[model samples]
Target chain A: MTTLISVPLGEHAYRIAIGANIRRQLPALLAEYTPLTPKAPALIVSNPRIWRHYGTEVHEALTQAGWQVTPCLLPAGERYKTLRTVEKIYDAALRQRLERGSTLFALGGGVIGDMTGFAAATWLRGIAVVQMPTSLLAMVDAAIGGKTGVNHPQGKNLIGAFHQPRLVVIDPDVLVTLPPREFRAGMAEVIKYGVIWDAQLFDLLSQLPRLDRMAALPAEQLLQILERSCQAKVDVVSKDEREAGLRAILNYGHTIGHALESMGNYRLLNHGEAVAIGMIAAGELAVTLGYWSAEAAAAQRALILKAKLPTTIPAHFDVEGLLALLQHDKKVQAQKVRFILPTAIGHGEIFDQVPTELIRETLHRLQA
Target chain B: MTTLISVPLGEHAYRIAIGANIRRQLPALLAEYTPLTPKAPALIVSNPRIWRHYGTEVHEALTQAGWQVTPCLLPAGERYKTLRTVEKIYDAALRQRLERGSTLFALGGGVIGDMTGFAAATWLRGIAVVQMPTSLLAMVDAAIGGKTGVNHPQGKNLIGAFHQPRLVVIDPDVLVTLPPREFRAGMAEVIKYGVIWDAQLFDLLSQLPRLDRMAALPAEQLLQILERSCQAKVDVVSKDEREAGLRAILNYGHTIGHALESMGNYRLLNHGEAVAIGMIAAGELAVTLGYWSAEAAAAQRALILKAKLPTTIPAHFDVEGLLALLQHDKKVQAQKVRFILPTAIGHGEIFDQVPTELIRETLHRLQA
Candidate 1:
């Protein structure tokens, strides 16, 4: 069974088709929602690792659907997510003569999705991009939001555009190949949905015995996690496509998470791992500010621990450095860092006036 | 007197304020349409030549309006319209700690407007961009539309996004310093508006005793040209924000114009000069195809000549070379060149099946 979550962004709205092995249904799915000209050129952008596994399947599927398919593979990892990397995609796009009606398929994790979406966004001033997220992190968050961009040298995702994907195909079967560490990184976002928007999802995640690997959960549970997480993203993005207001809540742990990733040079911690630690810090800050109960914060930290995600900041990190990095975050307004703090286990709200001293104390306490 | 033309793109709609020395009124105009946070940072993007002339005036005006102003000056001309130049803008934006609320003011010709707008469109996933066109070409054409991008190594505007400006300020007074060749180049697009959408504008230009220089026309005539040209742009763009349909009509001469520009290596011929020659080719093609009459085509040629613009392709351009370049154009749809051919002086239509033979003959006949 397929769970289709429709993101209601009016004309830019698209559907998230979540199922096991649903990558095979891409042609039919696209035909229904975003029908293209027969044999229109489509570029499949992925890294070697993801491409080695599923590139042939997607390529053949698109070709069989009467679409001309070309492959553009790039180096895998968050480090390669830069404008220079996007230029490589542009070179491939130009070589393929990809037109305005053509589509670019993002066939990897968040990094690939971002670069591909951005290339598609700017190529010919805009083109169709279909998100085929292989990693759990991409499937649940990056692939659905239409927040496509590449990292600047000084910051992560500092340069980008709000170009939504035409369709997002999430196949859980592919997560079997996702490394355990990568799997856990995706769980951080899944846990985020539970804390910020869906308490039921949080409770369901808590009920699971282990979430460190895909094998730990039943097929039904994995589907539920993908569905609920994607739906939560759709709910927020559909309401605030440009992060004007409500969409900022989706950055529950991202403000500090991004700074930590940058501070670590994007190597010390994977995005999910950094986010996990950031969530712990935000939870503690909420409790310290009397916004959220200590019991709720404890439960949140315990859940992260169960997922084998980090709940403490690295001891080498200084509060002042992290605070300085926070000011550079894309969400900063008038020099105030906007943080999404949970008031309860299931609800979070945007706070632009979070006291820096409180954040410093929280970070100091969370040092590993 | 200031002439206002509103581009109605729903929420993205903005107004074009046209007058003499309207640069001084930018602060008040932005306050009426796009109110920013007090003392919000604004990056003024211009080339050294444009900056040396009017940069101080714009900077001081913005500074007095309570904007924290920073100037990012780049090399002038089309060759500098590349992603590398945009990177300079990104670096400057980063240096200023430009937030999502900050605005980028493009204070030069088409090159500056395009690069600045593209930078704003992608900076922090997009911010505000106000187009302060300092050239006649930019005022009547590039500044009015949201088509913003830098050229790819392969083609013009191959890498771009449709990012509308918050406000467009067109100051005719700035044209005093514009070189004669540059002024005539702008007449190409002005004649385009007359041919494609406004016959009245065409007749008005036809009646102008001399269409080559600013001094040749009265102040009222200049304002009329600016107002009518901007209104024609607004009329087409409001209906088609993206070049999905009616908007392509604006590319009347651009199909061949872009190809010719590419053939000249973007150095031999200015955009307006290439476009002037392209309009002649398109007019001849329309006549040959029986979609338009020879008399009407002659009238267009006469008007272009009156503006002292080129009416013939350079003798060195071969038909085969130009044809091959057309395939790489952003407007080519599914291996077919999409040409905007004139049906009459005031009306034009998109033609995707323009015969290569006819274009070959048209080029053959127009060789200088």
Candidate 2:
């Protein structure tokens, strides 16, 4: 069964198609929007890992649909997501003579989607990119928004643009291949939607048949998770595409989350794990500041625990170092980092003037 | 006296302040629009050559107005306009810790403006950019439009974006320092404006006391020339910000001009000189194709000759090489190179289906 979600983003509007084994419908879905000429070239950019699993199937499907498809594979890892890797993709695009009419198919996790979307954004000023997110983390968060960029040496997503995709294809069948830890990481964002905006999703996850692995969940339940998580993202992004105001709510736990990830040097903690820890810090901060009830905070913590995500800072982490890293976050404006603290179980608010001593105390407690 | 021309591009609307000695008004004009924080850093990206002449004036003005100004100097020349140079500006921006509120001031010729604008576009996703074009070509052409880019190794401006500027400042007094040859090259674009949109401007240029050197013309006439040329650009760009339709008329001679520049390896011929030669070729092609009159073509050549601009292809230039270079142009869609051909003295239309044989014959005649 196929479920379609439409992201009405004015001129950059596109559709998100979610289902099982829907990868075969890729060409038909793309042709519905793209006025592709016969034999118009399409470059499928993927990592060796994902490509090894699904490369032949996607290649044959596109070729059979009359696309002159070429597979451009890259090394699979967050460390490889840089401008240098993007340059390699540029070389491939040029070699294939990918014109303005050409489309790029990004088929992998967040790293592949980001690097491919960025390359597509810049190639010939801008071109069409179709996001085929293979990981649960990507399908829920990274692939929905048109925010495409490579991490600069100085910062994450500091060098990028808001170039929307023509289509976002999320296949639950691909989730079966995703690592278990990675799947749990994606649940952090799922719970984030629940804490920040949707109380019903919070209840939905609490009653899930199983939250740790893909196999433990029923097919209908998995589809519900994908649809709800993606719909939450599409709703936020469609309204605030540039993250000017309301979209900042989407980064509910990202202030401390990014800092934790940076402190861990991006290798120690995956984005989901860091966000999970960050949400705990933010929830405690809210409870201490009297914005949210302690009882509600405990309930939120239980959901995170049930999802099997981390809710604590590292033992060796330094309070001062974490605070300093927090200050350096790109969202810091006028010397104060904006923190998205919970007002209720299903609502969050942007607090610009979070007292430093309070954040320091929160981290100190987490250290204990 | 300052002459202000407003480019009403709705949300992207900005003012182009043009006149003698307007560089002194940079601070006041900028402060009017930019809600600059106290001591906000402004990186002035320019060639050392232009910096040497007016750098102190701009620096002191902004510094006195409480702006923390940093002069990031680059080597002066068209050959230096590449992504490598843009990276240098990014480094400087990063080193100076330029935030979203920080502005990049492009202070040189078209090469400096284009490269600086591109760097500003990509830095921190994008920041504010103020164009202070020191060359006539930049003032009339490159600076006004939001089209920012760097030349790729394969083709000119293949990698770029459409990022509009916060303001454009054109100081006519600075043209006194412009070389005589560079001044004549600027006239090619001025004449281009005449042929493509303004017949009255063509008559105005034809009646100039002297068209070769800035010193030879009256001060008022210089202001008139700058006003009329810039107004032409503002008029066209205001209507079509993104080159979807009417804006292609601005590429009246750029199709052939870019091919010639690339074929010459961007060294032997400056942009305007290549454009001057390109205009003549396009005019003749227009006449041969019966789209334009012979009298108009001859009049166009006479004006180009009067301006001391090139009207012929180089002696050693290969026709096939030029044809091959034309194919690599970014404007080529469906494998057909689109040309902006003249319909009258002050009107041009996009011609996408010009036969290859006609292009070859035109080049053959030019070779003779």
Candidate 3:
């Protein structure tokens, strides 16, 4: 039941392996991708919760396959995604004597993946990292792209690098362990893939009997969602690894989503949750600007609602604060926030000159 | 008379502009290399000492050329080169609203150039960094290479990135204002270029009447040293940008140099002074290992002495401490310290299995 999608990024090209029982394939896959060198150990970076579930099996698997493994536990959650977290990983890698030939295995969700990826990026300039994403959000989005970074107090992803992993291993079996809230939050990015590039995925998501829980979806549908969403991201990232251009569409909801996540102190809203709200705002802005049909916007909203995702700004959210944060968004060009506005159900375009007044008015209308 | 050496690194290609009174040409040179876009300000990262001397003139030139510039004053010294110093540059860049097209001008010595380059490499993933190296050390070596990083508590340059600058503007006039000890230190790297890459340059250096002070050298000779040394570095770096193989030769004296620099707490010996001592150690080790003739080693030592540089290990320096630091060096491949030993004045080769006993004996004999 292994499905492989190749992300063709020239020298950095890698494959995304997805399935239910693919966790067992780590040794074979790691060997195939990056062969183990003598005395070079693999450092597995995971949070306590995820490590508690899969650490022993993974350790045994790698050890049996002939790798000296060192496990590093990181505190779970977005709040712990900082330079301090990266420093600890550096300490572990150095302590374990992970050489340039060694690989770092990121074995949790997006937080673990980002932190570990950034550590790999700066450790001895650059080293190999293998992404073993356990969450849907990471498998289809975060771990697929070469983007790796940590948050600054001033903003999210303020410190980072573009270090691609040697391989990405996605295990759907791990998703069953994810909470319903987290599963639904991950759906936000899945839905974004539909709106930005695949209208068929958008339509398929709308017809699901249940979208809130992983248990409710058929295995076939889950595989399709993972493959198509990953394909959409791979299709984009392979063209532009460093976001020189054409990659702005991948950041469809991130400009507003990052502001929301930062304003909430990364506690009030998870990444996917904030992006869900951001997409709604962007959809509304698109409709108001006459670029998207009202029917398309309504259909998008219905799908997001069906997924049990938030579609409105937080009730007590401050418009001015959001706007201030938006100005600091990394997507800002010439001091103007670059918004990826929907032109149609399956397309989005970069609109850089969107007036602040337009944003203000939209935020005012969306606020409860 | 500006001498331009184009470092052809494919997409990252840039030119080194070397001449007297070239500080005035920064505005025009910057325009030629990376044009200043309206509303995107250039953030100048420099120390108080260098900034106090030439900051205003450079500021006026950029401002008069239609760039909105922001100046950030850093504490001057190698000890201040750390992640904390980079945080301030990020703050200032963010404060000034620097964007992707915006450039960060490093307007001091190697320390300033390295810090600014690292800040730019991480800020917004990366931005353009323009190297304006004031000191002789920075102009000839640090500023020419794409290596950017800061000292980690564990080691020097333990964390960093290979970020090439968009342009390098070298103003030799700044060396006139440089202190005598600092001038002597800068000559160490210049001397290294001669020992490792160019015999003609070595002979030219040996013919100098006085090498301790900047005023003692003829202006034509000074310009030749800067240009030839920079050209040698450019030839190496353009071929091997990330030190995969060939560029390791550029680290001729760095194996011991870094250990000396680190053991001294980066205070007792500055980068160039430590390198001067390390070169002497490396030369002696080469002779002991039968890789180089004693005549060549003595010639190397004579040039170092002619430049008024130290030719022996520091008195009371701990041999064990320095040896321990050498093992942790980034150049250590598979637990063996990779040494670049000279076979002739113009050539050096990478030798990996230099016996630790040989190093021990060399240190014991060279000790004051």
Which candidate gets the maximum lDDT versus the true structure?
1
For residues B150-238, could you state the per-residue lDDT of candidate 1 as single tens digits? 99877788899999999999999999999999999999999999999999999999899889999998999999999999999999999
* Per-residue lDDT of candidate 2, residues A81-192 (tens digit): 9878988888888888888888999999999999999888888888889999999899999998888887777778877777899999889999888999999999899989
| Clashing residue pairs, backbone N/CA/C < 3 A, model 1 | none
Residue ranges of candidate 1 with Cα displaced over 4 Å:
none
The residue-by-residue lDDT of candidate 3 on A228-331, one tens digit each, is: 99999998888888998888898888888988988887778888889998998898889989999999999888888888988878888899999999988878
Q: After superposition, how far is residue B83 of candidate 1 from its true place, in Å?
A: 0.6
Sort candidate 1 into its docking category: high
Model 3 misplacement above 4 A: A35-38, A355-357, B35-38
| Overall local distance difference test of candidate 3 | 0.87
True contacts kept of each: 0.94, 0.43, 0.56
Residue A366, candidate 1: C-alpha displacement in angstroms: 1.0
**CAPRI verdict (incorrect, acceptable, medium, high) for model 2:** medium
Q: Which candidate is the best by DockQ?
A: 1
TM-score of each: 0.98, 0.97, 0.96
Best to worst by TM-score, what's the order?
Answer: 1, 2, 3
**Interface RMSD for each of the candidates:** 1.0, 1.8, 1.4
